[model samples]
Structures are given as structure tokens and as C-alpha cells.
Target: MTTETSVDVTRIPRITHDEATAITAVENRKFGEQLRSLGPDDWIASTDCERWDVRAMAAHVVGGAAGQISPREFVRQVRTGRPIVREIGAKHWWDGMNEVQVRERSDVSTDELIAEWDTNSEKARIARNKLPKPIGRLPLLNLPEPVGRQPLTYLFDMGFTRDVWAHRMDIAAATGHPMDLDATHDGRIIADIVAEWAGYFDEPFTLELTGPAGGTFTSGSGGETVRIDALEFMMILAERTEGTGLLQHTLPL
Candidate 1:
């Protein structure tokens, strides 16, 4: 695997607006399909997310989509959720927002949840893609260390899609749902992740990631070499599993 041609991390281009929009739409549809296929048992299954079952995970996805449908909706969620998060002793406002999301939809039936996801995900795609360039370039918030601050475009283009993709993996693990990975779509996302990971750590290493979405990536030379499954690597980066050494550094999902 190491013998495969190495991709220069610096050369990997940022995902363009069109690519981001397309990927987000595809991911949303796939997630909705996965939700629709869940059975009663699957809905209640425990996932890698410590506090969430499959149902709660789905609710979070729906809530995230709803918030992204409009700037007004997004602000409303932040305003309503930040105080609640502080009350709950959570460090991040998003934790409160996620909690509120799950609580609001706790009583929603499985079918209704699926329906809402379908509607809101579509609306989110439209709203995000329609964001004016000037607004998108503005910094959204100041995040913690490693991720000091991010622009609105980061959320629209990468953050939200990565969040849903990571959670989709979570749902699949809990329910044994077959993931529909392909070289084209999933591969693109994985490659982008590799680029970010390599750039963030900025050390010498060779990564041999196996599976349809996998590839060989290298940065500098003579660094630690790691071989792992592509999806599992992503799971680690998303902090769903413990990692060691270089892998311990993570990118926000």
C-alpha cells in the first residue's frame, strides 16, 4: 500500500463551492434513505455517540438541517440553546443546541422524523448554496484550540456535510445498515479529509488506507507510517474512537 503513488498534501485543492453543494445533497439523500430503512429495533439501538441512540442521532441530524435552512432559524436555535447548554454545564453552545434538537423531536415518530429530514435537508442545501459570497466569507464563530475560528463558508461547505457523514457512519454501526460507499463520492470526501489531516499535523508520514474510499497519502518523508481501513480512519479523526500518536490529533467532523 505504501508503494502506491503519494499525494502531496499541499497540492490537494480545497473543495469548491459546487463540489461542496453536490456532496452535501448526495450525503443528505443517503442519510435520509438510511433512516427510512431503519426498523423499530434499529431506531433504539445504541451508537458510538455516548449519549445518543439511533433515534436521538436522527433527531440531531434533522435539527441541524432545520437550523441551516435560514439564518433566522440558525440564530433562533443558538439563542434558545446557548442558555440551556450553560445550565446543563456543557462547555460548547452546540452541545446545548444538539440537546435541544433531540428534546424537541423526542416525541416525533420514526416516519415523521424521516419526513422532516427529507424536507429540511433539501431546504438546507438550497439555503446554504444560496448564501451570498460576502456573507459566506465572514467568520461564523471562534472555536476552541486547533480550530480557532471558522468562516460561514466552512460550515456551509464542509462542516455540516462532515457532521452528517460521521453520524451516518454512527447509525450504520449501531444498526448494521450497509453503507453505500463508492470510489467517486465517498472517495472524494475521504481524500479531502486526508488532505486536512496531513496539513494540520504537518509531519512526515505515510498513510495506507484500504477500501473503496481509501488511498495512499504522504506528507514530507521518513515519518510514522500508518495503515488502516479508510472508514475506520475517518471514525478515529471524528473522535468516535481513541487514537494514538499522530492519529490523536483530530479534525472537526
Candidate 2:
């Protein structure tokens, strides 16, 4: 989770709707392909996401999308908090969902898991398209403070898209497979992250990230400057690495 900082929701710049949709498509294809290339040993590998393994992380991605498309059931689960798993320490809505998703898919084969992800990723993309513009302007509930109050557009564009991309990075790192990231598509993702990360601080600062996703960015007024590799900057944002100065302010991926 990122440090919570109040931001004017209206002032935030989002990738265009098309870009958001494209992100979903491209991320899914890449993620699916990466999974396909992994073996059974890789599926059980641990990731940076605390207790979740590769399969569990992938299950959350697919289950999240499945929940979106199945409103009646999803709403029921939210309302009643049914099928809760106390044994796994399911303390929150997402935690419970993550547990359920992994449990439900426990018997599923690796190939099936990859196929299901491809299907659900597409569904998540389509579901985003069907949302009313007015709905996009509404605040998302129960998100981390500051970020929690942001509009649905921010959640879809910044939150959801980044979740998959971050997890893709997680899987690649855990499996020792080189992850594929491009300048245009991946740069857009990193830039959005930088913009939000910038919003967390009161003083001015400059960030210089050098690599495929690298770029120059300014936040607030004149203050300290930090230079880092683009991937390392992301590692800081994802809280995978400790940072100094304004870099210490973590942002949700």
C-alpha cells in the first residue's frame, strides 16, 4: 500500500480510455504468455506479495475479474461475507476473496489456470468498457486512504491495470524469467505511477528514472532531487526496496 496523501481527484491525469483498455489486453496477453512458459515448479514459487504464491496471485487476478462480471453473487458475498475462511486469517474483503479464489482454483491444472486468466482478463476489459461515464466519476470504496476516495476511473486505469502489471513483474522475478516491458506501453504505466507517487509529498522534488520506462518528472516546488533506474524506481513504489528522501513515500501499485 502507498502512503495516503490527499489529492484532487479531478486534477489527476489518467491514460485515455483506449489506453486503459489496451493496457488490459496487452498485460493479459503478456502475463498469460509468461505463465504458459512456466513449469509446475514455477507455479508454486513465492512472490513479493507476502504470503501469496504465483498460483494464488494469478487466482486473485482471475477471480477479481470474475467477481466484476458476476454482480449478483459478488454483491451477496460482499454483503454477507459468506464462505469466509477464518483458518487462513481472512480479515478483509479482498483477503477473503483472495483466499476463496485460490481455494476454488486449487484443483485446477496449470494449463487451465492460464486459459482461465486469458478469459477473465478479457472479461475484465469488457466490463470496464460497459461502465457508465458517470459511474467512472464516482469514488471507489474501501481503498487505502486518499487513494480510497479516488474516482472509479482512477481505480480502473491506475489501480487495476497496475495490479496485473505489478504481479507480472512479481512472477517474472520469482521465476527467473526475463519480463517483457516496452517503452510506450510500459512507460505509460510507470508515468502514471510516478504522477501518483509525486502527489504523496508536500515539498517539491525531481525524479529522474533512466531506462525503457524512464523519464523526468517534477513534484510540488523546488526541493531535493533523486536519480534512479526506472525499474528500481518501480521497486521503490512497489515497496520492494527501501528508499531515502521522498522516495520513502510508498504508493500503491
Candidate 3:
């Protein structure tokens, strides 16, 4: 995580490398456990990602284990600001990890899914730990300017936490299973995402979140803005959805 030495972070607490590592481990295990849950026939069913299914999501989880970051030589080429991955086509880049999954695990037994999870979890933990501390978040610099500098690292940290829960819903929705969240992952993500809505929206809008569990919502400081319990809201931020909704509920300053 990046540190702004000058900023007083009383409101936005930063998560450490170790914390990131642990969360990655948690996500990996959760994905495996969920995948292991399926009957053989369920692999081809639809998933939240639109074009993919349970199997494809499994492929993505495993592919995440592959060299997720660009190599040193490539990163060097991207020095000064341009992202190395940005130079490549989305399909081509995704293919790199796809290659890893197919090459390394083509023969992986269903029973070994959790073991693969453990392997990738450790690999991701070590790799993230070895990297330099973040200069800024936004793991990928996709947006155009100002907001591009948004706290993506926090988004990523929050994403993983949210992913485990959301994807559990994804899995559950696909397979008709029950949903339950561990307190650790649930609270952190809910907090960060709530704050993220406050930070992202231009208006001093207040949110009214309504989900299956209950109904109570978060409002920004000075009654800025509000976020409803729209799964679409979470999916859009997760990049699982293409566009945004109700971004500005009120007039801005």
C-alpha cells in the first residue's frame, strides 16, 4: 500500500502488505472451496461475469496465480508513467494467465482444487510482498486523469474482500446455495466501499442501502450522497458490470 506521509489518515486506515497477503490467501481458499462444491455438471452453468460460467470463473481465479504483474524488463519500459499492460490488448494480456492455467493445471483433478488454491494463495502472497510499496493505488491506470489517481489500492483491497462475498453470491446464485459472510471480510469491504462511494461521487449525496439482509444506509459527510444496496453498484465498481448507475443523486458544488 502507498503511504502519503503528510496525510492524516484517521478516517481512511491503510491496510498493510501482510494484511493484503492474508486476504489474498483467504480469497484463494474461498474460490477453491466454492468450486469444489459443484457437481461435475454444474461447471458449464452461467456466472455473474456475463460471458463466463463457474468453470470460467475458476479459470480466472487460477489464472490470477500466474505472473500477474509485468516482468521487471517490461515494467522498466513502462517507467515514467505509461503502464506496460496498457500496451497490450485485453485478450492478449488475459491470455498470458490463461496460458499458465492451461499449461500448469490442465490435468488438475477436481479433488485437487483446494490444493491449487493453496498453491496460488502462497504464490500471490509472496509476489505481492516482494513488490515495492505502492506509489499510488489503482493497480491498473485505466481511467483518464484526476480520478485515475483515486485510491485503487484500497479499492483492490476492498475488492478482494468484496469479491469473496460477492462471488460467493455469484456462486450461490449460480448453484442455489446459501450466502454467509465472515465478519472480517464483510466489515472491511462494507466500510471501504461506503467510503469509496462518498469519495467518488461529486455531490454531497446520502445513500440508502437496501439489500436482502436488512435496510440501513450510509451518508457522506455534510449529507453529501448516498449509495443504495444495488448489486449493480458493487458489480460496476468490481468491473463486473460495464457502466454505472445513479452516480449523482444530488446537485454538486
lDDT of 3 by residue, 32-133 (tens): 667777887777678766545666666555545443333452233324223323433333344344434433555666556556655665665565555444
Over 4 Å off, model 1: 1-4
Give candidate 3's whole-model lDDT.
0.49
Q: For model 1, where is the 10-residue window of minimal lDDT?
A: 1-10
Off by over 4 Å in 3: 1-16, 68-109, 134-140, 143-166, 210-217, 220-233, 239-253
lDDT of model 3 at residue 147? Answer: 44
The candidate with the higher TM-score, 1 or 2, is: 1
- For residues 1-253, write the lDDT of model 1, one tens digit per residue: 1225777777778788999989988999889889988999999999998789999999999999999887787778888899888777788989888988898999989999999998889889888888899998999767765676878888888789989989998998889877778767788888888886677666788888888878788788888889888888888888889899778888777
Estimate the TM-score of every prediction: 0.94, 0.85, 0.62
Write model 2 residue lDDT over 53-151, tens digit each, in one string: 998888877766677666664675454444574655665676666666667778888788888887777887787788789988887656663355677
Ranking by lDDT: 1, 2, 3
Judging by lDDT against the true structure, name the best candidate: 1
Superposed by TM-score, candidate 2 places the C-alpha of residue 253 at a distance from the truth, in angstroms, of 2.0
lDDT of 1: 0.85
Shift in Å, residue 115, candidate 3: 3.0
* Clash count list over all predictions: 0, 1, 10
Span of 10 residues, lowest total lDDT, candidate 2: 1-10
